[model samples]
Target: MQRRTWVPIATGIVALVFFALPSEEPLRGFLPDWVSLVLIYWTFALPARMMVGMAWSVGLVVDIVSFGLPGAYALSKAVLVYLARVLALRVRTYPLWQQTIVVLGLLGIEALILTLIDFIVSGDLSGLQRWTAVVVGALVWPVVYWILRRARHLARLGH
Candidate 1:
């Protein structure tokens, strides 16, 4: 992979580690979904390179780490990336709030898809708690974007 590719991959790995860390509180549930935010950002910014299969693979790793229903996140991430790609042009033109709204919507759909899969596989509804994490991720989107943009800017300067 090129040097530019490593940044997003490394970011994804760090996100996976953060999400995989054990936690006792209810808020800990949201960590796994952070990868969706990272993926969306990169998908929009680098659509030529960040393909759906890559998203699916990253999602699979998250699934393995979280020990959730297998393939749940993999499928969701694939869909998220697909939507991001389809909407990339329009999304890039929108203001930050509009972009965040779109991301929030995508995150919600991802959560719903994962919940449906978990329900079908486990026949249990306990995964609803994970929605809180999605909500938190949505609320934090602007800050996440700002940080990511700054990092990208710094990386450009370094190069």
Candidate 2:
């Protein structure tokens, strides 16, 4: 496969690995939403290559890996892709710091969708603490964006 094909796959796998790693109760919430961050970065950086269907598939993998509600993550990720696609052009122009705000909003929406699904399926809202990851993800957006952007340049994935 070409670099375009394998690079995203490799990055996605890394995100999933980070997402799947075990953590202590106190530290778990601090782990950024690596999967969502990657999806957003790719969506912004390569709008034509990253589609809603692809996001859904990645979310499904996340769902399976996390052992959550079957379609919860999938549905949320699909929605995230749709929203990201709609805002891709605009978001891409912003400086990385400003883009961090947008990323926070996007990740928050994903969290909302997951929270709603959890409520509907299990009647438990869990805790507000779960949102810590959203904040962490926003703060980590620059790093994620920089890393992926560097990778893209390294691979010579020209727009």
Candidate 3:
């Protein structure tokens, strides 16, 4: 099979693992948004294969598996894909530090959107803990990118 095929399979595996991980207080509220990161990463890495529709589908799957509010995560992920597309090329050129900053900002937006949804549905404000995931996600972006980038290269997906 072509490497391009492996990319999405790898992403799906990662996302499932991400959702499967048990949340444990400080960490519970702040574990890096793993699926979100994978969604964002692959969306930008292979826009042709990963786009808004795919993000929505994956988000819905995550919501179903995680028992989150339906459409909340799906919508937020679609929005993130739009934002990532807007900055996709720019993200590729930036240094790892800069890229991490951008990922943090995107994750922040995702958290903010989810928080708004939580307020609408449950009237609970996530407070500062909602941002913990953004910070953690940003810190891990380079590692995720490195591994995925190598996979992309091996798959002959384009530079």
Candidate 4:
């Protein structure tokens, strides 16, 4: 692994776990996309280092843990990172509310790609769960990004 703060690595791992947890509760169908959300936050915050390959690697780990067509998430995540990388500067410069909207679009695109891949693999579209994740993630981007931002900055200040 490349040299970087453990904060993000830990956050990413936690997000993956959040993704895997059973969402059987009411409205849980719209479990926020913790992994992608964190990835987007890190990508925008540290655009110089969070490259497409990093996204690919994270997706591969996810695929290995999650049961599905391998490379499906890898591709979707890489696409998300690629888009984020392209828009990192302008996106980061925006207000948090505006940035959330941009991230929502990216998350929706990633969801669409993943849903399409799922349909292609299983011949049926996932109902609600996929899109719901996008909506939920987008809705929470600001709070998660804000918390992570503060956490990252605080750690730096402590050191």
What lDDT would each prediction earn against the true structure?
0.79, 0.88, 0.81, 0.85
Ranking by TM-score: 2, 4, 3, 1
Where model 4 places Cα greater than 4 Å from the true spot, the runs are 1-4, 157-159
What would the per-residue lDDT of candidate 1 be over residues 29-119, giving only the tens digit for each residue?
6554668888988877777777889889988888898887678888999999999999887788899989988988898899888778878
* Candidate 3: regions farther than 4 A off: 1-3
Clashes of each: 0, 0, 0, 0
lDDT of 4 by residue, 27-50 (tens): 677887788989988888888878
Query: What are the per-model C-alpha RMSD values against the true structure?
Result: 2.9, 1.6, 1.9, 3.1
lDDT of 3 by residue, 33-99 (tens): 7787777777777666566887788779878888888899899998999899888877888888888
Alpha-carbon error at 137 in model 3, in Å? Answer: 0.6
Give per-residue CA lDDT, model 2, range 49-151, as digits (tens): 8889999999999999998888999999999999998999998889888899999999999889989988988899995765988998899888898899888
- TM-score each candidate: 0.88, 0.95, 0.90, 0.90
lDDT of 2 at 76: 95
Best by lDDT: 2
Deviating ranges (above 4 Å) for candidate 2: 1-3
Deviating ranges (above 4 Å) for candidate 1? 1-3, 30-32, 157-159
Looking at model 4, which ten-residue stretch has the lowest summed lDDT?
150-159
